[model samples]
Target chain A: MNIHEYQAKALFEKFGIAVPKGAAAKFPEEFDTALSQLPEGTTVVKSQIHAGGRGKGTFKSGFKGGVKLCKSKAEAKEVAGKMLGETLVTVQTGPAGRKVQTVYFTTASSIKKEYYLAILLDRATSRPVIVASTEGGVEIEKVAHETPEKIFKVFIDPAYGLADYQVRELVFKLGLNAAEQKAASKLIRGLYTLFWETDASMVEINPLITTTTDGVEALDAKVSFDDNSLYRHPEIVALRDLNEEDPKEVEASKHALSYIALDGNIACLVNGAGLAMSTMDIIKHFGGNPANFLDVGGGASREQVVAAFKIILTDPKVKGILVNIFGGIMDCNIIANGIVDAVKEVGLKLPLVVRLEGNNVVAGKETLAKSGLTITSGDSMADAAQKIVKLVA
Target chain B: MAIFVHEKTKILVQGITGSFGARHAQLSLDYGTLVVAGVTPGKGGQFFEHNGHKVPIFNSVADAAVATGATVSAIFVPPPFAADAILECSDAGLDLAVAITEGIPIRDMVRVKRAMQGKKTRLVGPNCPGLVTPGTGPKSSGGCRIGISPGYIHQKGHVGVVSRSGTLTYEAVWQLTSKGIGQSTCVGIGGDPVNGTSHLDVIKAFNDDPDTHGIIMIGEIGGTAEVEAAKWIKANVKKPVAGFIAGATAPAGRRMGHAGAIVGGTEDTAAAKIAAFKAAGIEVAVTPSDMADALIRAAKAQNVKLS
Candidate 1:
């Protein structure tokens, strides 16, 4: 759903939003080629990753600053070399961080002023809103919390697009000069169009700069599209970076199961999203950390249950597995049998706990009991969590 | 006596010829819902027989509505065509349209919401578990089940249950039902990032209902809906309310199962919503199991007869 900064910038350019010339390079050796496309003066080498706070992020190689201001192509090459193959740890990226597979090299711009601009769906209003502020190059969340008055918002009516008066008010509140205001209005309009056209969930340009040379340019870009709408846009789906996502998650997606790996030893497999979260919460509340959050969905067939178990077992940290299902449309017998089959196939070594409720629950429990597997079946959620915690702990 | 659908509310099934649509349609009909008509493009004049009874299928919602006089529609259309189905139902001047489809693109919903500005239809769940009114009319034998949740989990009682998650709604309802605390009606506003109905809409309906004595509201981390609902309850609702929120231990920035369950900002968290509920004099359930007990206690304190 989230695209890299270079990809976002490319989208910005495609939408007629001015952005500095840049090229993405996979290797340090290709830095020269990328730099040649830029103004050849001062270039900014930005590490390409999904997480924000990259400027302050440190590379695993002990190279400071994910973003490097390089005066020479050799310096850019050195920075890119240090970052291209190294793992980056930012405030946004967890302690384990993401491996930087690509680096963006772009021409540095002379900025007279910086402004924060983003277009996101506001939850309260249930509409797409444009958020702008005079403060830039800092965490907008912190700015909003500290100086709430500084942040200005304009909610867009999706039916009519961004209203003319709304854009005019936003630009005026941004406090730009006459010519700069004109350009800002055009840029904001184009960005809104891109947001609507591409079905983007968020389009953020931190430090939308009023450059000394150009009228306006996006210094940094982060864009995420609505995943549900991706079917209508095949081109957007192709931009998904498999490297940036957890392998287990991507694999789970292929199987239509929702899985997010966590740092724990108890792997949880639940039927629904809400139930899955409650399962995890109960596991944690009972003093057991869940290894992963996995929801097999409502209508999971036996094959999908098997696939979910396989995905959970793939995480070697899993010391115990808890299968908590409240089958409605999902059959309990299929899940119970699938667990037995998956355990037989994967050669289950970890302690297993099973809890089945809802329709066909008695049949499901009977199926599990008849499977002759060493599974601990619990009566309730609390009982299940306690049993799993005791076994894992 | 229920908030949304009851015995007299004639139901129409959209996308009726499809497997998903037909499955739930049959289930709804079997549950004693008066499913008079079905809509499937190009399947006009077809009959979908269920339990020895034939329900007529039409090419469009307008034709289906005109023929069947069905005011309520349950949508089983796929995600891509779901918005159009809602629009069609809305365009036909249906009273309520329950959209059971999940993964509807927010863009399409945005347009759908815009088109519904002054429309007669009230949309529920582009990714929700539909509404069920358990305690009204003769046909409410299985409680007029229109959504995905099993009818066996519900009973005819005074508590009004509204939730954001479907399975969780079932969990809460099952607990309430098993403990002899039957529900008057239960509604899943849905767990999509952008949905049609909200806790406020459903709670307002519950507040106006004469059958609903006390209410059990289930929310998760996301949106300011719960917080806003708390404020509304403080101002308007007279009934005793018990609240439960899932995903208390969920990690920040993680989409805890539901697309709409993400913690977007500081205000949209379990802690924040729980605090808001407490501030509004609503009983808060700490754990999922505690929800039924909490609601019972709240109802007892307010002189609500649970049995």
Candidate 2:
């Protein structure tokens, strides 16, 4: 759903918003070509990863910064060389961090002022809201907590879209001049249109900076589109970088399952998103760490269950497995049969705990009981977690 | 005394003949729901027969409502066209619409929510299990189900359950039903990152219903809706409320499958929600099955007897 900064800036340009002259380089060898295309000035080399806090992020190679300012093209190439292939560890990216697969070479500009602007869905109101503040280049969350007065928000009615007066009001609140206000108004309107047209969940311009040229520029952009709407935008879906994602997770998605790997000993397989979370919660409550989170969706067939089992076993850290399902429209008997068949085919070595409830539950329990496998049957959600955690411990 | 659907609630199936719609429609009709008509664009003048019972199909909700006098609609349309279906239902001036479609674009839902403003139609979910009220009269057309929640797992009782998750709703209902507790109604508001209904809406409905003496609220991480509901319950709701939140062990940033299950900060986490519930004098269940025990205690505290 999230696109890199270069892609976001390109989309911004398509929407008539101005961004610093930049080019995305996938390889360090292309760094010279990227620097040559950009405006002749001090260039900024930014490592493009999903997680933020790149300026202060450290590379696995002990390189100083994920983002660096280079006064010369040679320095730009050197910095890109350091960041192009290394894994970046920021405050947002965990210790393992993300590999720097792409880098953006942008012309560094002298900023007259920096302001934060974003369009996002306000859950409480069920409306897309435009949030702006004079303070930028720092954590907006901190500004919200400490100096709430500096932040301003305008909730745009989906029926009417963003009004011209609303944009002017935000511009006025941010203390922009007549010329800058006019320019800011245009940019805001374009950004809002882009958000609406693309079904973007969030379009953030952290530090929508005023350049020395006295014009508005989206300094650092982050655009995330609504995943549900991607079907209408095939062009956007093509922007997905599989290399940036966990391979196991990509594989799980191919099977119509949701999986997120974690550092734990217990592997959880549950139907329904909320139940999966509860399963993990109870696992931790019983003093067990879940190695991964996997949701086989409301309905799972024998093949899907086998696929899920195989994915869990792929994690060498998994000590035990827990299968929790509450079948409503989904039949519990199908789940039980799938479990038995999975263990038979995959040859499970780790202890497995399963708790089935709802439709055909009696048959489901009977099926699991007669499987003659070494799987433990849980009486309830709590019992399943306790059983799996204890067995793993 | 149920909150939404009961006897006399005529049901219509939107996107009828679609795999999900047809399957649930047949199941609901068998379970005793009064299904009067089906609507699929260009499939008008057709008859969808199941179990020797024929349902007349209409081109639009407007024509269907006019012909069948259907007041409620359960939608199983695909996500891309779901918003338009909801708008059509609302436009037809239906009493309630249970949207079973998931993955509706937020932008589309934003427009849908706006279109629903001040409208007669009350929208339940875009990604939910739907609403159910048990104990309708046999002659009544409103069946045992309005959504995907199993009809067999419920019994007519005093507890009203409203949840944000689909399967978790069934789990709680199963626990209560197995323990001899019955439900007046159950609603899943869906897990969309931004939805049409909220915990507050369902809780307020339960609060006003005389049949619902105790309430079960199931929430998860990611939104302040639960905390807000707790505050509202403390001030207005007189019935004993039992609460449970999923994702207590979930880490930050990772969305637990549900679009709305991402922990935004420390505030929306399970610990914060449970603390809010306890602070509001509601019984908090540590586990899903513990909901039965909590509900029993809640009902007992209010001098409401089970059985």
Candidate 3:
């Protein structure tokens, strides 16, 4: 659901929020043309990736800085050349890093001061909260932890939308001048509109800078849309970059499965989200590391089970698989049959342990027993987890 | 003696004409619940006949409530119209509205919640398994089965259960039932960030219920609702409470299937929630399997007779 900085800035412009003129190039050949679109000034070359900490990131080609301030257009093009098609390793992007499929070039502005601003749901209030701070261009969490008072929050009433007073309060708290306050207020309102209209989960602008002309702008934009609301906004969904996501995860989503790959050997397949999470926790508690967390949802049909099995097998790190189902509404027999068919289809050699309970569990267990597949059945979740961990070990 | 529902509570299905709604409606009827009516907008004046029960279908919640005297509604409407369905129940002044539909937009829920601030109806979930109060009959068939939870897994007893996840709640209930323990009522508050009820709300209800002797609360990594409930339990409630927090192995910023089950701030992490539970004197289950045992330990320490 996350969009790149360039995409976010494009969205910001649509909402009348000021962002530095920028252009993106997917190839080195397009880099020169992209740089040409920017005004002749110190240009900022940013590697396009979904993760944060891009400025501090390093490319795999021994190139320094995923984001760099180039002195000229030629320099910006050179930096873009170095970034495009190279893998960027940021703090958020793990060791394997994200490959830079696109590079953005923006005109670097002279900043009088930097400020932090964001709009997201405050779960406690069930309301959208505008978080602003005087300290910007750095991690807001660090600021909130260290200074605390430097950070200010304004919770918006969804019924009334963002109030003028709330914006003024934020502007005043950030110690903006009259000119800057007017621009900040307008920018904040526009940003909130973008957030609300587009069904954004979060809209963050780190280092929201005020130029020497007292004009406020979003220097770095990070926006993520609410996945559930994506159906209403096809335009927003079109901005999604499939290259940034793991292929296994993408494949699982296509099959309506929720899967997040991890570094362990024991793969977990559970019926519900909370159960899937706890399945991973129990595996770890029993001295086994979980390789992934996969939820086949409430009604685990045979095809979904087969698809899940194929996805799990794709992970060579996974030495064993554990299927945990509390079949409240789901029929346990269907799940058992799916497992039997999946094992036969995939030629699965990994240790498989299943703990099936609730609704027609007797038939489910009988089916598993007669499968003649090397699948182990445990009496309980604990028993199943223990069995899988031991077999893998 | 259940907190929200019982044997005589009249239930209605909102999207009864739909496959999902009809399927669970049949299951509820099979479980011997008094399914009084169905609401499918245009399918009014029709009867949802299943297994010798001919439940009337109405055009609106108001019409359905007036005609059938149904006090609670189980909503299985699609996400787009689910909010309107809940608002309808609120307008009709129903006692409870359990939303079983998932994938509702946060914006819709936020507005629905705001609009229902002073309303009479209590909303349970938009992506939940619903609530169940066990009956005394074979496989607990006569109880009030509201949503998609399997009624046979429950047993009529004193312990109250509340959870965010459907299967995890079942896991705890099954474990308790396996140990010859029975539950007074089990409630799933749903896994959305903007749900109708919170852990604190259910915990308070369970604490106030005279029949509910002990409680099992299963929460995942998310909002401060669980922590707030634990703190309240520490101050006011004398009833033994056992707590289990999932997503201990979950990474930060990853949504674990459930829209609400994501680690955002430090306070919402599994470690943080577990610490809060321990600090509030709630027995924290080390693993999901130990949920029932953890409650038993808490009950033993407090000298509570949970059935």
Candidate 4:
């Protein structure tokens, strides 16, 4: 649901938010053409991947990790060719890392002022709030921590839309005078339009910077759309960066793991994510390691359940598999049946511990009671995690 | 009779005739949720019966609302049609829309939310365990055996139970019923971050009811919703509110099953909510059984003697 900086900036530009003039180059040969297309002199070649921490930590000082600043077309092409099809492992890419497929060629903007602007759903207020800070570029969370009041927020009513009045308020608050207000208004409006059209959960223009020319531009753009809302926007679907994602996550999507990879080795597969995290924590509480975090969600099918089982088992280091299903909407008997089928088909040699609750627990227990699949059924989430740790240890 | 829906609150199933739709329709009718119409977009003018109440399945919520005066909708469509289904109900002006579909994208919810702006229609959740009013009767119109427990578990008195965890609510209800601590209403608002009615929204409704004397709140880790509700409980709740936060198994640094249940830091932990509620002078339960025990104790402290 996250679009690349180039695509986000392009959308920003369409709405009159000035972005560094750039084009995404898919092929190494396309780099020259793409660079020539942009106003040439000094350009920033940004590595296009889903993760962050890219420019400095990931790539070597200037010419490593596919992201390099070059003055000549030949240098840009050389860097692009080296980075193309190469898997770049950056901090943002996570421990497993993702393959670099595309790179963005952008004309570096000369900045006089750097400010941060982002809009997110504030759960406390139950409304979309626009967060703006005079200080940009660095982590906004840190800035909020150091100087909380500098980050002014304006709660937006979905009914009225983001008004020009709010933008004017922000423009003045950010210390921009008359000339800057006109351009800043355009950027805010463009972001709002893109936010609506893309069904984005977040649209952040970090470094809503001012150029030496006294004009405003969005130096970097980050837009995260709601995955559930992807059905309405097909155009955004094509920009998915699948290569730079977790293998288990990719497998989980089709197999439906509701899986979010985390640091652990116990491989907790619970019926709900809330319950799953607790299960993983309890494993650690009892001196155990969780291999990954997976949620089957409510009312999962036998196939989906089996698929989740397969995904967990795929991790070779997974010493134990914890299946904790509260069985709220889903029946415990159905879950038991799925677990039985999964053990038979997938061959569960790993130690298995389960805590199934809810409707038909008796039947579910009866089904699992007879299954001699090296499984132990606990009475509670804590008890189950404790048992899984005992078995694994 | 239930306040919003009863045996006669003309109902419409947005994906009527679909497998889940048909199954829940049969159950809902049995539980006293009067389902009057079914909509399948292309498969209108079809006839389906649940508990001998001929539910005329229409093509859309608008059409069904018009044809049968259906004022409520229970959506059982696939996750993909969730937004459209809710919007259809809101546009048709259903008093309340309960979305039973799980895995609805957050983006779709924002749009659906935008669509419901300024409207009277209130949505439950795109991924929730449908509403339950216990006994007089229930939304069993969908026949989801999950929500329909042994009617004996609830005593139909004055306890309002609200939870983010779906099945946990049923466990509490079942235990309360066995103890003869029946409820006025028990709502299982699903764990998704952008669900329609929040814990506070449901609690306010419970507060207005004269029949309700005490409240039991169940929350998991993740999101500030529970914390926000705790603040509300401290400020406005007149009745004794007993609480339990599940996800004791949730580790310190990961998102649990509910998108909102992830522990961001020590402050956002389940322990944090329990402490806040305790500081606010609300009774706290450590486990499901403890939750039942706490509610019983809370009820007794308020001196509401049950037969």
Candidate 5:
């Protein structure tokens, strides 16, 4: 659901929010052409990745920063050459880091001041909250924790939309000048529109800077859309970069299975989200690390279960597999039959433990017992988790 | 006495003609719930005949309520129209509207929640398993089964259960049932960030119901609803309360299948919630399987009888 900085800035421009004019290049050959589009000035070369902390990130090629301020067009092109196709490791991007597939070149702005601005749902109020702060270009959480008074929030009424007064209040709180205030108000309005119209989960601009000319602009844009509402906005969905995601996760999504890989040996397959999460928790509690979190959903059909098994087995680190189903409306017999068929198809050798309960549980257990597969059946979730952990150990 | 539903509660189904809705409708009918009406916007004047029970279908929630005298509605409309379905129930002034549909846009729910501010209807979920009050018959057959939960897993007794996840709720209920413990009512408030009801709402309801002696509250990472409910239980309620928080192993910023189940900040993490629960004197289940036993431990410490 997260889009790169360049993609977000493109969206910002489409929504009438001012962003520094930028062009992206996928190859070193395109770097000069991309730099040519920008006005002759100090250009900013940013490595395109989905994670934050890009400016402080280090590339695998021993290049200093993922984001660089080049003095000339040639320098920007050189920086872009160093970044493209290089892996960037940031605080957000784990140790493996994300490979830079694109590099963005933009006209660097002369900042008079920086302010933090974001729009997201405040879960407590169930309303969109505009979070702004005088302290910008840094982690907002750090600011909120250190100088709590610097942060200001304005919750907007979804029914009436964002009010003019709310924008004015944010502008005043950020201490914008008369010229900057007008621009900030308009920018905030546009940002909210982009957030609501595109079904964005969050729209954040770190260091929303005011140039020497008193014109306000989003210096850094981070926008993520709601996955559920993606159906309504095909344009937004088109921005999704499959390269940034794990291949197994992408494959799981294609199969309608919820899969998140972790660095462990015990793979967990559960029926629901909460159960899947807790299945991981219980594994850790019982002194076993979870390899992945996979939820087969309510209907765990034969094909879906088989697909889930295939996805889980892709992780060679997975030493054992645990199938936990608290099938309320789901037929346990169907799940058991699916497991039996999946095991035969995949020819699984790792220790497999299953705990099936609820509707038609007796038949389900009987099916597992008669499958001619060496599957361990546990009496409860605790028992099943213990069995798998022991088997893996 | 159950908090929201009982044996006498008349239930209506929205989008009953759909496969998902019809399937659960048949299950509810099999469980002996009084499924009085179905609403499918132009499927009016038709009957949803299942197991010899010919439930009438209406064009609108208003007509359905008027014709069938239904007080509650279980919504199974698709995400795009689910919010509108909830709004229809609110306009018709139904007592409760349990939205069983998932994947509703947060924007729509925000507007729906705001529009229903002072309305008569109490919304349970836009992505939930709904509520169940177990019957006294075999496998608890005759009780009010509003949503998609398996009725046979429940037993009519004194313990009250509330959870964010559907299967986890069933896990806790099954654990209790296996221990010969019965529940007064079990409610799933859904796992969306912006749901109709909160843990605090259900906790307060359970606290007021005299028949509900012990409580099992199941929550996950993300949001402070569980913390709020735990704090309230510490202050006002004398009932024995046991709590379990999932997603302890969930990495931060990752959405754990559920739209709402994400570790956002320091305050909403599982560790923070568990600490809050412990601070409020609520027994915390170390694992999901220990949920029923944790409640029993709480009940024993408080000299309270749960069934």
Candidate 6:
């Protein structure tokens, strides 16, 4: 689960991280009022979206007509109206621009220090890593490529909490003064507290900047929580914006299944977590776009398979579904019944490609073939992948 | 006979009265595994029946292990109490412990890992489906997941398979069984970073077993455990081996289910491990169906036959 930038900042501000005050507006008219609310100076206007690459689209296109110095309120309103609802090209959307639903306007601050900060899962260590960098305002990935030494990654001890000594050292490495150092420590500590309390998988603040002797504030924030841990956190659940997510993904999560909506036409559902991923990859390799990754786990029953098919059919973009089951302990016949039941109940009409292996594979193929649902069975994975790819193509 | 667990390994359930715990414990005891004791703090003195015998209940791991001489512990505590339960089990000097609970804090596992080190104790999972010594011990907890796969899928043979994926292990065992291969033992090492032992740990035990012959390895994309084991297999293990990896192209951006099952982690993606295995001249299966053929080919290629 991921939260928007403003929501994360609100949490940080509540924890006493001094952040610049700003208002979120959806239109250029709201933008003008938002700018007027800030101190009469060069104000920074940022696009608010769940994904990155706002500047590459709307902000540059909408806000760039002319710099109208508004000493009065009237000038701001007219300028705001033009920018409202206007689509602009962002790096995210390519030449096609993403719609700007909201614009954040705030008084720009003097940055004496800039650093990168994020809490991400380090899979090798299976630990949450607190990565801080002296170089701020730029994407940390670039720093990783150009100057890897600048990034200092500290693996947080989830049991003991973030070590205070490590906090002090991180502050020192960032080259902060006494006052900034204290504030940074408080921010990092508070961030950790928020991370734990909310069960966040990641909390990122790019360009956590220190103003000239004033205080440190988060320039941008991104928070991601463990979906499995969401049951323990009601507050995080209330903050979830259904509008910011893929509708198919939202529906899939309800079934306790992991679904990543892709730009593919093949709706692939496979049993076993590992096999599901490979199924998707094979679909892609066979010149078909995979619409999702659905894992029915190892012991997927007829019911689970039905639910998986329903989830895939929900996506209109799906051209067909490829059902790949490598029969382990999970009976392939049970899974075939699920596929038959789901198709039967939902009146599903998409082409189905199935490649089954192991126990009762023959019986499973026979069951599906007799189900009378445009079913295609392959003796091998390559054959299955090729059939689906051709069907969609 | 499987190492670490067999018919004689006395078992104890840490949360015997819980729903999933008691139910699975019943299933396990029925399967012929000797379950001597159960432990649930404050619920001590209560007893449960397994394998036609009434087992004594205790309040702590030490009490259970000591009183019953239990060597293996199965923990069904919820996430919040998981670390403490494992620690207590470790302190009891048990030889092996399985923590079937999920969402354990990394710090807790680290401490548990450190404390269990140099001792006779080994921990299986902080968040996983509990281990099963099939046909030897009772499948203890309802959630500990015995026979989540079909019981008949295993042929009861000489191949010892170790994997980080719990379900995949069931899948591999099923595949091996269909090909007329019975497993000496199947181990899910758990995908948690702080969880006990590695692929190498189980492989070492399998290598020492005279009954165990060829091995089949199934790994997901994440961590270096599989890669590291491939290297070890290349150097040591006098057995024919073949491998398969799931999530071959798990989008570079998207992650797998377990926080630990990511294939795209530091120097160990599924591609990387497969590369290492192929470089070591190991036959890698392209799909689950191919696993049987690959393992068969590896055996023939090595001119090795299981007795």
lDDT (0-100) at residue B108 of candidate 6? 54
Error of 3 at B298 (Å): 0.9
Q: Assess the local accuracy of residue A41 in candidate 4 as a C-alpha lDDT between 0 and 100.
A: 73
Measured by DockQ, the strongest candidate is 5
Docking outcome class, model 3: high
What iRMS does model 1 reach?
1.2
* Residue-by-residue lDDT tens digits, candidate 1, A1-393: 999999988988888999988999987678778878776568889999999889899988888999989997677877788898899999999899889999999888899999999999987777899999999988899999999899999988877888899999998998888889889999999999999999998899999999875498899999998888999999899899999899999999999999999899999998888888888888988899999889988876778878888899889899999988887666778777887898888788889999888877888899888888899998888899899999988
lDDT of 6 at B155: 51
TM-score of 5: 0.99
Candidate DockQ values, in order, are 0.74, 0.81, 0.88, 0.34, 0.90, 0.37
lDDT tens digits, residues A43-68, model 4?
77777877666664343233355457
**Position A354, candidate 1: lDDT:** 93
DockQ-sorted candidate list, best first? 5, 3, 2, 1, 6, 4
- What's the lDDT for residue A166 in model 3? 91
Off by over 4 Å in 2: B136-143
lDDT of 4 at B74: 82
Alpha-carbon error at A151 in model 6, in Å?
2.3
Question: Estimated TM-score per prediction?
Answer: 0.98, 0.97, 0.99, 0.85, 0.99, 0.84
Worst 10 residues of 2 chain B by lDDT: B135-144
For model 5, what is the C-alpha lDDT against the true structure?
0.94
What does candidate 3's lDDT look like per residue over B1-307, in tens digits? Answer: 9889999999999999999999999999999999999999988999999989999999999999999899999999999999999999999999999999999999999899999998889999989999999999999889999999989999999999999999999999999999989999999999999999889999999999999999999999988899999989999989999999999999999999999999998999999999999999999998998999999999999998987
Task: Tell me the tens digit of each residue's lDDT in model 2 across A90-135.
Answer: 9998898999999999988789999999998888898888999999
- Model 4, B63-154: lDDT tens per residue? 88888888878888888777888888888888988887877876567657876878999888756666666553332222222222333234
lDDT of 5 by residue, A6-123 (tens): 9999999999999999999998889878877888879999999999999999998898899999899888887888899999999999999999999999999999998999999999
* Superposed model 1: Cα runs more than 4 Å off: B135-142
